[model samples]
Target: MRLYWTMPDELRIHYKNVLQKYNEEFTKGNLSVAWRHLERAHILGQPWPREHNYVHWLMLKFGIHIKDKKEIIGQIPRLLIGGIKVSLRRTAS
Candidate 1:
C-alpha cells in the first residue's frame, strides 16, 4: 500500500482546523457551512498530495450524504487526480 503522509506543519494546522469546522457544521446539519469549510480545506491543502486527496474524499462522502449527483461525480475525478497533480507540481517546481 502507498502511504500518503501529512502536510507540513504550517499548512497542516490550518488544514486540520478547517476540517474540524467541516465536521462540526456537518454534524449540526449545516451543509452549506460544511461545504464552505471543505472548500477552504481544499484550498489550504492543495499543495500537498495527502491533504488534497483526503479533502476530496471527504467531499465525496458529503455528496453521498446529501445525495447530490453532480458533487459525487465531481469529487470522483478530484479524488483520483488531485493528489497526482499536487505531486507533479511539487516535482516540477
Candidate 2:
C-alpha cells in the first residue's frame, strides 16, 4: 500500500485508468482483456484489495456460486488478508 502511494501521482493516475479499463472490460464480459488490466493494476503496485474484483469475475466465469463457500475460497489466493465478501445480488445465485 505504501509502495503504491510512493509512486508519482501521474503514474498512479495512469494505473487508476488501468483499473478503470479493467472495470470496463469486466463489464463487457471479456475475461482475457480484463485479466490484462488486473496485471497492469498489479504492476502499477496497486494493493491486493484491488484483486477482489477479479475473484468475482472468476466466480462468475466458473459458475461458482457464493453459497458454495469452500469453492469460492479455493478460487482465489489466500495470501490476501481479507476473505471473500460476496454480494448476493451481484454474484451467481
Candidate 3:
C-alpha cells in the first residue's frame, strides 16, 4: 500500500520461505507443490505491491512453462494491475 519499505519480519520470512519452497519444488518437477507454494506466496504478498506483482510475474512464467493457456491468459491482467489495485485499495482505506 503506499509502496512502503517496512514489511513485517515474520511476513518477510514466510514470503521468502514460500518462494524458496516454490523453487525447490519446481526444480524437482513437483509442479503441483510449486503451484501451491506460489499460491501461498500470492496470498502472503497481497499487501505489498512489489511482492504481489512479482508473484504474479512468477505465476505467469509458471503458466508458460506448463503451457497452460488459461493460467497464462489469466495472469496477464493480474501481472499488469494487481499491484496498482492493492495500492489503490490501501489508499482508499
Best by lDDT: 3
- Backbone clashes in model 1, listed as residue pairs: none
For 19-82, candidate 3 gives per-residue lDDT tens digits of 9999999999999999999999999998888888999999999999999999999999997888
lDDT of 1 at 56: 92
Error of 2 at 26 (Å): 0.2
With a 3 Å backbone cut-off (N, CA, C), the pairs that clash in candidate 2 are none
Once model 2 is optimally superposed onto the true structure by TM-score, how far is the C-alpha of residue 51 displaced, in angstroms?
9.6
The Cα error of candidate 2 at residue 38, in Å, is 0.6
TM-score of each: 0.90, 0.47, 0.92
Give the root-mean-square deviation of each candidate in angstroms. Answer: 3.6, 10.5, 1.7
Q: Write the per-residue lDDT of candidate 1 for residues 20-73, one digit (tens) a residue.
A: 999999999999999999999989888788888889999999999999999999
Q: What is the C-alpha local distance difference test score of each model?
A: 0.88, 0.53, 0.91
lDDT of 2 by residue, 1-93 (tens): 122214467776887798788778878888678877766765554233334455444544433522566745654553243323323222333
Ranking by TM-score: 3, 1, 2
The candidate, 1 or 3, that scores higher on TM-score is: 3
Return the lDDT, model 1, position 3: 38
| Residue 45, candidate 1: C-alpha displacement in angstroms | 0.3
